[model samples]
Target: MEPLARRTLLRSGLLVAATAVAGPALLTGCGSGEESPARSDGKPRRGGTLRAAFTGAGAGETLNHFVGGTALDMVRARALHATLGDLDPSAPDGVRYGVLETIEVNGELSAYTLRLRRGLTFSDGSALTARDVLWSLRSPAEDPASLPVYKNPAATFDFAGARVENDHTLVLPTLAPVADGRLLLCQGNYLVVKENSDFSPEVATSGPFRLEEFVPGEGCALVRNEEFTHPELSDAPYLDGLELRSLPDSEARAAALTGGQVDFAHDLSPVTARTLGEDERFTLTSTSPPYVSGLFFRMNLAHEPFRDNRVRTAFKLAADREAMVESVFFGDATVGNDLLSPGFPDYADEIEQRPFDPDRARRLLREAGAEGMRVTLTTGPETPGMVEVATLYVENLVAVGVDATLEELPAGQLFADYPAYTRLPLAASFSVPTPALPLYQMSYGGQNPAALGWDRPDVDELVATARGTSGEESARAGLAAQRALWEEGNTIAPVFKPFTTAHVPGISGVAEDLFEQFPGFSRATLS
Candidate 1:
C-alpha cells in the first residue's frame, strides 16, 4: 500500500466568508430563561469561515481517494466530496441517504442499484456520472496494493461488475451478497473521484469544496464548488471557504481553542473538553468514535511461546483497562469489552469489558507453562493515551513474571507499509467509514491488512453468508457469529472505544450525528 505521511498544522482562524440569512441564535446559561441578546435569530445564516484545529504528527503526500490516513483526510474530504449516505456521528442510526437517491437490497443484496440526483458535479466543473463510480472502483481493483483493504475478503466491493446503467443509475454486482450495503457505500472507502484524474503527488476530488492550497505538513484551504448542488443542506457550508490546520500536540491545540485562535477543534480529551466547556465563547459536544483503538498481538502459532492460548489470556489480564481509561483517557472513553461497537445496531451485547486481574493473568501464564516470554508491544506517536497505557502494560506484565517491551514507531511504519502478521498499522487503526465491514475484513477476511495471519473457515463462512443474505435476521446472525469468532480468537485486545469531542462557539447545526462531524452545515449560522 502507498505510504501517506502525517501532516501537522497550527489551530488558527479556520473560518472564512459567510452569508447569514439572519443573526446568530444567542444561548444563555444552563437553565437560564434569559437568553443571550447577542444570539436571537434561529434562521440559517450564511457566510463565515469554519476553522478547525486537528492534532497529528504530520501530513501525507496524497489526499486522494485511495490514501486513507489522519483526521486531516476526514476534515478535508468532508468539504470535498459528498458520500452516498450521510452518517450523523452524534446519534444512533442517524445516517441519512444523501447523494445516492435510494439503496435497494433485493436479490439477497448480491445486486444493488444506486441512482444519482439529476445534477452532480465535482469541484472542477466535471459532471458526476455512473462512469465515475466505475472508474473509481476499478482504480482500487487495478491496484489493490495501493488500496490496502481490497486484499481483505470483507472488502468485497464489486469493481469488475460496477456498470453505468444510465446517467442516473449505477449497478453493482458483488461476489457475494452483503447485509448492510449502505454501510459500505457511506463509509470512507467509497470516495467518488473523476475518471482519468491524475493522483500523483496530489489528489483531485469531487465535493462541495476544491483543494485550493495544501502545505503538506501545515494545513489546507478549500474553496466553494461553483457547480455543486445539494438541496439537503440549507445554507450549505455557510461559508465561502474552510481551512483545516493541524496542531500536532494536544496542549497546543487546547491552547488555541481557549485563545480563540481557531473557530473549532477536535480530539480534545475529557479534561480539555471540560475546560473548553467552561469558556463562554465555546461549546463542546462528544460522540462515540467510529474507530476502535486496542492492543493487537501477532500470535505466531508455529513460532515460539505464544502457541498456547493461556499466554494470550495472561497478557490480556495483565493490562489494567480501568486504570488506562481513567488516567489516560480521563474517563472520556467507554471500556472496550467487545470487538464490535454499539454504533453497529446489530452488534452483540455480550462482548462485555474484560476486567484486569494480575493474579489471574499470572496464573494463566503459569498454567500455559510459559516462562520468561519476551514480546514486543508496538505503538505509534499518534496513539493518543497510548504512552501511559503502554507503560502500564509493560509494568503489569513484568509484575506477572512476563517479560515485555514497548516498541514505539511512527504510524506509517507500523500500518501502511508492513504486512499484518508481524506489525499492526498503528496510525490507521480505526475501522471507521462504518465499523461493520471494516471490522469484518480486519478480523476474518483474508485480505485485511490487520488480519494478523489468523483465519477460521467457519468465521469466513459466517461473514460470507452474512454478505450474501439480504434478510435482516440472517445477516444479524452472521454478524453475531463474526463477533463471537473475534472474542474466541483473542488476536486483538480491544482496550476502549474513544469519543470524538469538538469545541465550537456561536455556531449552530453542530448536531451529535455519528456518521459525520458537521451535519446540516448548510443550515448552520454563526454570529
Candidate 2:
C-alpha cells in the first residue's frame, strides 16, 4: 500500500501549536500583586529562571529514560530529548509532531513514513537524521535491560522492515496494522537520542533544553537548547534556564510553591489545591475525566479469588467511589464508572455504572464459593492521597465480608521493579489522563508483559481494527473495544482525580501534555 503524499499531510497542518488546542481547566486570578500581574496583553515575556517541583526522586534517576520511571526523570528527559510527537490535552486522540515535519501511514496502516524537518540539529551540533528516529523506536523494545513500561510498546513495531529512504525520511513498518502508530512513537520514553551514542548527560540532545547538571534523587538544572528548531518553542528561550527539584511530600511541595522557593509545583493534595486556588498569587490548573488522575487498583487474575469474574465484579461493587472522592480528594474529583472516564475518545460511557453495593459484593463472593475471602491491598505513597484512598478501599472491602488488609510500601517502591506492582494480588495505583487505547495497550493488551491476567483475544482484535482504520469506523471499533474492557477489566477506578499543578502567575505557555507526568516546561516563561 502506498503512503499518503507528504504535501497532502503537511497541508493538513497536523503539527499545530500545543497550546493552540483545548487544555486543562485553567483557574486564573484577577489580582494586582507584583507576583500576579494582569496579562491583558497576550505576549510571552522571555528570560528568567523557572523553578518547578515534582514527586519521585531517587538514586535510580538516570539520563537513560528507557530505564528511568520517575516523574523527575520524565521532566529531565523532556528538557534533554525530543520525541516524534506528543499528546495534546485539548485533542485527546490527536498527535502533535515535534522533530518530524510530517508522518503519513499507508492505506493499510501497516507502514508509516516519517519525514524530519529540514536542518534539524542536536544540542552538540550533530545532525538529526532518520537513523536516530529508527534507533529511538527500536532500541528500547529490543534491549533486554530497557524498562518494561517502554519495552512493551516498542515490541509491537516491525523494526526489521524499517527503512531509511533518505537523510530525512524513514519508513516504520508495524508488526500489524495499527491506528495509533504515530502516538506510539510519541510515548515519553521513546524520545530520540543520537544513534550509537551512550546514554549520558553530556550526550547531544534535540529538545528545548540541554542537561546542565543532574544529581540523582536530588534535582537537576537545565539550560535552553540554542539549537531547538520548533518555532513555537524556540522563538526565544522563554526562561533563561529551568531548575527542577524533587519534592515528594504534598505538604512540602505546597510549602515550596507558597514560600516562593519554586515557581511551579505538581501533584499537590486536593486540600492544598483548593487553598492555593484561593490565593491570587498562584494559578491552579486541573484536568478531569478521560484524563483521570485518581486512585485505582489492578487485581491480579493469577490469584485464586481474583481468577473468577464474579469475584472481580464483587470488588468493583465494594468500592465506595463517591466516599473516597469526597473524603480523600476533598470533593475535587468526579466519580468514575468501571470504565475509562467519560469524554475520552474510546470511553464507553453508555456502560452501566457499578453502584457501591456491599450486599451485592457479599452475594457475589458467596455465589463464587469464596465467602469471607481474605486479601491484602498493597499500596504506597507514590502519589498524594494514595495511602488514604487505599485505607478507605480496605475499609470498604472489609465491610463486605472480605478480610482486606492494607500493606503500604515506601514511595517509588511500587514501580521500582518492572512488573513488581503486577505481581501482587491487589495493588493501588494512579493514572494521569491518557487516551483509552494507549492506556489499554500498555496495561491490559494481550502482548503486555505486565498484564494483570486480563487477556481477551476478541477485545484485542477490536482494538487492532480500531487502530487500523480512521474516522467513524475507527471510533466505532475503538468504542467496541473499550466496551469489552468496561464489562470485564480488572482495574477498579472509582474516581477521576484531577491532574493538579500550581504555578506562579508569572509563568505562561506551560503546555498541558497528557503524556508527561508534569506539564511541558519547554515553552514556559516568566514575566
Candidate 3:
C-alpha cells in the first residue's frame, strides 16, 4: 500500500498562518509597502556578484555541514552543496524537491523510497545517484565530528538495511514508523553530496553554486554553476557569482551593508533595522506568516528556584509580552502564547494567549514561598530580539518582587556548548517555524539537551497517538499533548518574529530564499 499521499493530512509551512498583530508597522516578507520580487519592474540583471554577511564563529567554523558551528558555516554549506529537499510553503507536497524528485511512503509508515531526479550531476559531470543520498544520510551517524542531534536520529533510520533499487532510486526500511519521515529527512539540513566527498573547494558539489575559495572562520567565494538546475525553479542562480562575508556582530553586519561593503546583511538587530529600514539605501524585510521564529525563555527545571512548577508558572505569567513585542521588534512581531509553533496545525493555539499578570505572578510566588527568589537570565543577541526581550522580562520579574538580573553572553558563546546551556538556571532560546509534533519530538522526545529537562511520558504517549493517527483524530491527540505541555511546560515563549534582514534595493528575487536572513542566492539577482 505504498502511496504518495504523504502530504494529505498536513502541510508544513503553508498551513494556516497565525493572525498578524494589527499595526501598519508590522512587515510581511513581501508586504507592507516593500516591493516583492514578483512586483519588481524589468527583468533581473543576471551577471553581478551578490555579497552578504552573517555571524561567524572564529576558528571554530567548519565547512562540514554535519558539524557547522555557526549560521555562517551552515550558510556556506548550503551555497556549496545541493539539498535533498527543503520545506517550502508554496510546494504542492510541502517540500521543494532538490535532487530527489519524489518520496513514496508505505501504508504501514515503516518504509520509504527516495527517487532522485534523473540527469542530476555534480560539477565534475559525474552522475548523482541514490548511493550519494545514502552516503550523505549515513555520514551523520558515522562521522565522529557530527552533532548529537544528527548522530542521534540514526536509530530511527535503518541505513544498514536500506537498499538502492537503481541508480536513481533507494528504498529504506525504517527502524520505527515515523509518519513525518519525509519532514525528518528533508527539513533543509540533509543535503546530498557525492559519497565520501570531503567538502573541500575542489570536491564536485551538486548545488547551484560551486565553491571557488574557502578560508576557515572567514567565508567562501562561490561561482554560479552553469550546469546546475532546480526541479522547481526556472534559470535559478541569477547571479554570476557570490561572496559570503563573516561579520559576527549584528551592528557590523548592518554597517557592512550600509557602507557598500556588502549588498545584504543577515539577521540585523531590531535597533539596526529601525535605523536602516527607512533609509533609501537599504530595504528591510521579514518573511511572510508561518516563517517566523519563536523567541523563548526557558526555566531550567534541573536548577534551583525554577525546580518548582508554581515558580515556573509565575515566571511565565510575569512576562510583559506586549511590551516585549512593541519595544524589541517595534511592532513587527507577533506576541507568543506560552507554547511554540503557533502557526502549525496541531499547535493547540486555541489554548488561548498567556496573559501578562504580575499580580498573578506575585500570588503564585507567595503561595510557593518564593516571593523574592533570585535568578539570572542568561541571553545574547543570537538573533535581534533576544537580549531586549530578556531585559524587559528581567524588569517584569523585579516588578513582581523577584531578584532577576541579566547575563549577556558574547555573540558566539551562547550555545557553544549544549550541556552547559541546559544546566543554566534561566535562559533564552528560539525555534524556527516547523510542524508542532515534530517540533516537540526534536527537543522534548527524550533527554535531548534542547528539551532543557522537559521529560513527560504521558505527553510523549499523546504525541505518539497524534503521529500514528490522521486528520481530526491526529489533531485531537496533538492538542491533548500540547494542552498538557502548555499547562506545565517550563519554557516561557514570549514572541514570534520573522527572520528579518536588510538588503540594498538592487537585490531582488530572494523572497523564496531557504534562509530568510542569509538569502540563498539560488534565485536572487543583483543589478
Candidate 4:
C-alpha cells in the first residue's frame, strides 16, 4: 500500500457559482420569497462579526491542523492558515487556485513548480517566503524524526528533492508522476505555517484570519489577518471577525441559526434543513455525489469472518442501501455503489452495483462456513445519522441469518482511542466524498494503521500507474484501481448523504468553501 499524505480540500466556491447561475431556481422546490445572497443585486456589505456552529468538538482540538480531527479544528485551521490551492466545485473536474499564483506541472507529472504571489505576508508581520512553505510541506513527514512528540501522517510526496528557486517560488518533486499534484497540495490540512515556529496560536499564519482565542471542545474567536493576500479571491477577510461555536447536536445547530444565536450552522438533519429551507429567513445549500456525506461499514480484515473475502462479499450483497437512505437519511441521500460516489472525476461507474440479495448473502455465508455467525457491530453518534445507519445495518445482517448485535459508543468516545476504532471487528463510520486518489490513499492504500486491512501490491502498482499518467490513460488507470476496491475493498459505503448547511438571508460568501463544513466566513459579508 502506498502512503497517502493528501489533504481534504473542500471546493465551497462551487456551490456559490452554482447558486449564481441557477439563481432562485436552485431553491425553488425547497422554498421561495427569499433572494439568495449570492444573487442579490446589492454589493456585499462587509464589517461584522459572523458567528457559526458545527457538530462535535472535543478537548483534543489543537492548533496543529496536521493532528486535528474534528470539524471545529478544521474551521479554526482554515481561519489561521492557507493552503496552496482549493478545488473549484463549479468546474467539471473540480480545479482551482488558492494561495499559489501559478502551479506548473511537468509533462510527466513527477515534478511541480509553485510560484507564490508577490507581497504575501503573515499576520505577525513576517514576510511569507519559500522556506516557510517548504517547512510546512516537509515537516509533516520529517517532524517525527526531529521531534518525537509529532505523530501525524506524512504525505507521500518526495520532499528529499524539493528545491527553493527563489523567495517566492519553490519546486516539489514527487516519488512518482502525479496527475493531480495541485489537488494534493490544496488539501484542507496542508496550510502553511512559519518555519521553525512552535505549533501555537501565537505563531504567524498565512490565512485570511488569525486565531484570537480557542477553547477546546467549546469554540474559538478569530480576527481578520490584515496582511493576508491571495491571487484568486479579490476581497480578503470580508468580516471584521468571526466567532465559531460548537453545537454537536443537529437540532441544536439548527436552533442556533433560527434563534439568531449564530449567523450560520452546519450538519443539520434532513428534517430540520427542510423546515428551514421552507422559511424565508434562511438560505439552504447542499452538494451531492462526489461531495456528499457517506456512511460506511469497515470490517477489520484481521478478524474472523471478515478475513474471508466470501464473508465480506456476503455483507456487501446484503446491504439495503436504498432502505437505509429512506429510513435513516429521510430520502436526502443518493445510493452508493461501493466505490467513490458518482459525478466525481475518475469514478468507476462501470462496476456493477451490488443488489440487496439476502439469499445470495446467506449462500455466501454458508459457503464461507460462517452460518449463524454472531458478530458485534460497534457504532456511535459520530455524525448526524450514523447511529440510525448502524442500527439499520444490524437489521440487514440479521435478516441474512447473521446474529449481529449493536454496540453504540458515546458521541465522541468511538474515536477516543484511535487504535481501538480501527481494530474493531466491525464498525460504522462516516466521511465526506473526496477525490478518488486521495481518498483511496488515506483510507485504503499502504499500511494505513487505522484502516481496515485490505491491501495488495497489484492495487498499489495500479494506483502508482494512475498517478503517473496523464489524460485518458490516467483516467483509465484510476478507474481500474477504483474498480478493484469496489470488488474487494474492506469497507461498504451504501449511501452518499447531502452536505447540508443553513445561513441567514443576509449572508453571502458562506458557501465559498467545503472544508469548514459551512461558509468561508472570511469571504462572507452581512448585508
Q: Report the number of the highest-TM-score candidate.
A: 2
Error of 1 at 477 (Å): 3.6
> lDDT tens digits, residues 334-411, model 1?
665435444565455555556778898888888878867777667653535555566776777788997777776653
Question: Going through the candidates in order, what is the number of backbone clashes in each?
Answer: 42, 3, 2, 5
lDDT of each: 0.56, 0.73, 0.75, 0.71
**Can you write out model 2's per-residue Cα lDDT over 1-527, one digit (the tens) per residue?**
01233223222221121121233322232321255333467767766678787776456666787766666777777777876777654444466777887788888877888999888899989899999988887778777656666765555577788899998999888878887876666654467789976887678998888877666665677778889887345475566788777666666666666655567888777877887888878788876555556578888888988888899999999999989989988888888886654666567676678899999999999999888888999988777788888899899999988888999877666777765666899977777555677667776777465667888889988887887777888888888887777667788888777778887776777754335355667677677
Worst 10 residues of 1 by lDDT: 14-23
Model 3 scores a TM of 0.86
Per-candidate TM-score against the hidden true structure: 0.82, 0.88, 0.86, 0.86
For all predictions, the C-alpha RMSD in Å is 7.4, 9.8, 9.8, 8.6
- Local lDDT at 349 for model 4: 76
Lowest-sum lDDT 10-residue window in model 4: 1-10
Clashing residue pairs found in predicted model 3: 29-286, 237-522
Which sections of candidate 4 miss by over 4 Å? 1-41, 89-94, 142-155, 514-518
- Relative to the true structure, candidate 1 reaches a TM of 0.82
lDDT of 3 by residue, 219-288 (tens): 5678888668777766787788787776677776765565455677788777777877777667887775
